[model samples]
Target chain A: MAVEVQYYVLLSMALFSIGLFGILTRRNALLFLMSVELMLNAANINLIAFAFYHGNLTGQVFALFTMALAAAEVAIGLGILLVLYRNFRDVDVTVPTTMRW
Target chain B: MIYEQIAFALFAFITLASALGVVLLREPWHSALMLGVALLSIAVHFVMQAAEFVAMMQVLVYVGGGLILITFAVMLTEREDATDDTETNADEVVQT
Candidate 1:
């Protein structure tokens, strides 16, 4: 591979940080979910890059597994957001502070 | 080698920019579109590394399934911000 693995690492890092920024700054729950996905894909990029570098299929396998988990996560997350909307009539993550114990 | 370098630079830029768009865009709808762009570019990154299956799945799962869900949420959860503009437009139509 002419492209050094370093480039992938840097790209993934930038993507992950962008996700983190979204999570930290945005209050809307759906935006938070998207950011989390961004972070997850960043990790996947690393796995695949290392897999290619090492000449094994393990990284690709795990990347598939990660994709599965991400799918399930979004499903459950959207369900919860639906409920959050029904209960609070709003999707603001902060609004659930009313659930404080 | 030259082509690989150029492709990496191009897609890396695309991935980063659209990712930033997902974070920085004010409207959830627009953010969803940006997320789609970001995911598709990430898939390209996968292809560059010879993970063709992963790239296809990225397009199928992330863009097809995940993005649709996100757009549904954005549409369903659209609350305060869009209401006024819609209301004003409705009133204008009635007056006309």
Candidate 2:
């Protein structure tokens, strides 16, 4: 049997769950960032796959916008991480409450 | 039937493996590098699905812009300590 669109969707979901797990469990600040990227990529894959399956340009366009937003997010996030590291001399995110909330 | 299935399986494996590597690796820098590889592979997969524009944008925006920003973030954050790492692991960073 040939591979189907649903297979891709399932893979995307599985990858998304793994990324979520990483985000929930990992303590390293950078690894946490990568996990967030992984989740975003999972959503992108689903969008693009559906775009292909449906023969439309919408999903792809959405993915492009998503990529743009992700870029902006990382830029701001990195700036904050830089300052946080400087203030605390560490990047562990557990102490965020003492600093912010 | 079998050959097509094999190819599809290979592509799936490559994608899943790299995605997993992004989380599994110990070093933050290596994880970012692997994430780039995963994004590039995803771009190729998009091409396979006949999404030429998405594929190109994936390369240009994701690999070019996103990955570069991530690497720069890693470089700017100077957390040299390997121990005492604990995190909240919540607060999913989302725009909007």
DockQ of each: 0.44, 0.45
Over the stretch B51-88, how does candidate 1's per-residue lDDT look in tens digits?
Answer: 99999999999999999999999988888645443221
Chain A, model 1: TM: 0.96
lDDT (10s digit) by residue, model 2, range B15-47 = 789878887777778888889888887786777
Best by DockQ: 2
TM-score between model 2 and native = 0.85
Q: State the lDDT of candidate 2 residue by residue for A7-36, as single tens digits.
A: 779878977987898887777677777788
Q: What DockQ number belongs to candidate 2?
A: 0.45
Kindly list the per-residue Cα lDDT of model 1 for residues A37-95, writing each as its tens digit.
99999999999999999999999999999999999999999999999998877777766
Residue A15, candidate 1: how far off, in angstroms? 0.7
Off by over 4 Å in 1: B83-96
* CAPRI grade of model 2: acceptable
